[model samples]
Target: MITIPFSFIPPKILERLSKHFLNWGAFLEKLFPFLQQELGKANIKISAKQYLAMSFIATFFLFLFLGFCLTIIFIESGKVLGGIFIALFLSLFVFFMQSNYPKILANRRIKKLDADLLGALRAIMIQLNSGVPLFETLVITSKQDFGELSKEIKIAVDEISGGVPQIDALERMALRNPSPYFRRALWQIINAMKEGSLINKVIENIIINLNKEQIVQIEKYGSQLSPVAMFYMMAAVIMPALGIIFLVVIVSFIELDEIVVKGIFWGLLGFVMFIQFIFMGIIKSKRPSLLEE
Candidate 1:
């Protein structure tokens, strides 16, 4: 579970402001229908309206801060209009980014769950094969250090302990979790339990399927990495270096002012850094989540 970062305002003040904008937030929630489910998947306990309201508040503060700083810079350069435009653009960017933050956290949780799922399932299978009851197996799995998977199992265990039927608890877990593989495994277990089949046999089949899926993911990732690496090298390394040299030559031939040359170099540096950052993110995002650490 992640807490939304809005340190610019006190939590109490932010909460108050968010409540004041609840109607607007409700309208925005209707525009982005999936937000409520994403909040659950991300383990954020707040309602969609509350979260969206806070996002708007944070974005509003960000815009004010940027406007202040950029106004000073643009005032010196006699470009106040340009500063306003840039600040508006940045504020909107931040709002959209905040809107997707729950989904990002959900994806992160899915990756953590996927990374530890196989080991956790194997532990469960072993315990069951040793004649441990399903509920006890789940409790033991929940106590183990299986990262996010352990935490999710703990939730189900808690639900069962609180008088929920095992099948119903497991079904709720499957429905709320963002990982397809985890949900599929849970559904299979629920089905096996319903049919009075051997739980160990169902778990074994799930392990085999997961292993095959992991292998396919690895193969696809390998095929993707070659081209992605090539693109990264061209875009982030060779192009930046060559472009800098070309720009330097042009500036020299044109007898550009020293300040202008410095500004151009700084802009190119920023552009190169941006390209490198984007390529790094792409490479990390392409990594197969199921790979063993």
Candidate 2:
């Protein structure tokens, strides 16, 4: 195996470190060799200490928030036992959810990386066609001097060096990424290798197909977003505006001194607020994470 120059070591380590923070659960696959067999990347790159620190920091702060919220509820509602019970349940819920949050996001990110895996391989084929040796092509391109594409390639190269078979290494990457498109492309690459055939044309074909797939994805996202934006605008602006108009009409035409009129207005306002919350949830669910792209 070629040794990485001392000059490149710091940046490489730093990049690996930051990558764990960006996707912690996925990092676990790389941390344990046994886990690597079931995962995408096999690097043992991130120290166990890092995730330990993460878990500690997260639990400490979450408990504090839970305590504070419980205190507030106890003071206002005068139900200490009930508040404590609810708070305990909520604290556990938040702890697990918050602890898993980074991993969930990382899983999605890994999947996207997998989706982009075939593209990276195609780039490698291009580099090879231009006479760059496989190892150097991997080393240079994996360094991410070319962007995130390099980072993933670098990890794949690491797996190869770590004595993992090429097919397993590719499979690990596919497992980690969990993108069906990426898996399809990777399986094709593996098949080409098994047949000992030229990959240049196949690589080009895969690139074209990936581009088309991405365009279709963009269009689909666009369709989802357009309706969401319209809904938000209608719920946030149109509904509120209509509510205000109704309020004015009631004030001008009806003697709202009766309790029933006031009750109706309050009921309408509450219903509107409930609808707003439901719409907000829909918007949140529809929007993709900022990290995916």
Candidate 3:
């Protein structure tokens, strides 16, 4: 393996730190299972142990870098207590980022899967109604260009071909997937198989419900965009422009120190960028997962 600068802490050390020293098992028991499940759904090949190790290592390095920068800034500025506060804040930020990385990946995967779900499900229903067996329908779907859903169904097809029963394989896939809609469809298919109900009709009903859900989501998103766009405009554009103009006007009237005036200008710029990032996150969070484009 290629050695990196941060490789001083061996993987074993990180693993042991995660397992015994931190007692992560006790505190993380609730969240780690879902993390593992998300890893599977996201098609990430790393184990939860490996994922945790990587996250810790990355977090440590990130904090290390931030600490160095803050130390220099605080020492030059002669603010020892502020340095400590900044270090604590960075630690908390690292903790949050480490804890949520897997969830972020899983959410991305779920979005991609949902984006293509309607088309995939419609194709499956068509194949089933045409008298194709469930296994063949999945295989055929897997051969298509449905993105993550296709890749996931391909995994199910591989499992079924490897001697796992179709229903069991489908159930396993559904259990590991992050989307409730995906799981509900799989459960209905499983039930249809058990009860000898029409799989085609079950899938058709799912299609209709999913379509209704998409329509509702579109309406909600449209309603949501107005306020978000207004906030973005005020915080990121209008506020910054007004602040810079006010600062310039004040500078023209008073003899402020060059350092203080520069600091205000740069600080305002950073705040504007920060607000833009917050609005970007809000937009991402509000976006419906089922949107394909």
Q: Number of the top candidate by lDDT?
A: 1
Sorted by TM-score (best first), the order is 1, 3, 2
Q: Candidate 3, which ten residues in sequence have the lowest lDDT sum?
A: 1-10
lDDT of each: 0.89, 0.59, 0.79
Please give the distance, in angstroms, between residue 276's alpha carbon in candidate 1 and its true position after superposition. Answer: 2.4
Clashing pairs counted in every model: 0, 2, 0
Cα-based RMSD of candidate 2: 10.0
TM-score of 3: 0.80
Model 3 alpha-carbon drift over 4 Å, by segment: 1-54, 61-65, 72-85
At residue 189, give the lDDT of candidate 1.
97
Model 1 / residue 154 / CA error / Å: 0.9
Over the stretch 16-63, how does candidate 3's per-residue lDDT look in tens digits?
Answer: 555442444334435666776766766666566556655556566666
Residue-level lDDT tens digits of model 1 in 34-100: 9989898888888999988888888889888889989999998899989988998998887888899
Error of 1 at 228 (Å): 0.9
Worst 10 residues of 1 by lDDT: 1-10
Maximum-TM-score candidate: 1
